[model samples]
Target: MAGVAAIGAADLVAGFGLAGALVLPAEDPESVLAAWRSLPPDTAVIVLSDAAAEVLRAEPAVRAPDAPLTVVLP
Candidate 1:
């Protein structure tokens, strides 16, 4: 379970049969967007707070048909 923050890191795991999970911070929408863009198709992105989820949903790029984005509220 590696924390990937860039496209290069995501590329490293390509074809390794590894599942990628991105845990995003609530306060940093830009970071979330960056991470979302960096991940490969089918990556599971978990947004930790509603604030972050809102931010993610607002970003048009985050709504990829092939990727799964989940919002986990506490």
Candidate 2:
């Protein structure tokens, strides 16, 4: 798991030219929340699953009290 996380972090830096963090998790809400929290303000989030988007949409903190969360679903 540690090795996988290292590789994923490396891949993100290599591909995105970002020293940004990447969180790959063992399960659902935790992974989703981690991804959400790790991203900076105004950054775009692209979700591969509609179901996951739905879950994300339901989180008030994810959307915020005033600002809408930007998510692209494929």
Candidate 3:
């Protein structure tokens, strides 16, 4: 399985998939959650765009104590 995943703006993450990162160019919370839920279980890192990070502010799944490392882009 892949080691990294990304979810956020299309323009920012659209090309990340080329590098083998699981990229989901999503903007809404629903899409964001869907992206997260669909990631390969072995994914280790997750990068979120500013907007996508905000959408997940109150979300526990992605913020779980044992969840993958998450980085929020500025």
Q: Which candidate has the top score in lDDT? A: 3
Provide the lowest-lDDT 10-residue window in model 1: 2-11
Ordered by lDDT, highest first, the candidates read: 3, 1, 2
Give me the overall lDDT of model 2: 0.41
What is candidate 1's lDDT per residue for 1-74, written digit by digit as tens?
42432221223323233444343332366765665666655455443445555666676665666455554454
What is residue 42's positional error in candidate 2, in angstroms?
4.3
- Give the 10-residue window scoring lowest on summed lDDT in candidate 2: 1-10
Candidate 3 C-alpha lDDT tens digits along 1-74 = 54988899899887778888888889788998888888788988998898888888888887688788989987
TM-score: model 3 vs. ground truth: 0.86
Clashing pairs in 1: none
- For model 2, residues 1-73, the per-residue Cα lDDT tens digits are 1111111222232333343423333135556556555554544433323444555677777556544334333
* Superposed model 3: Cα runs more than 4 Å off: none
Ranking by TM-score: 3, 1, 2
Per-model lDDT: 0.47, 0.41, 0.86
- TM match of model 1 to true structure: 0.47
Residue 65 in model 3: lDDT: 81
Instruction: Report the poorest 10 consecutive residues by lDDT, candidate 3.
Output: 57-66
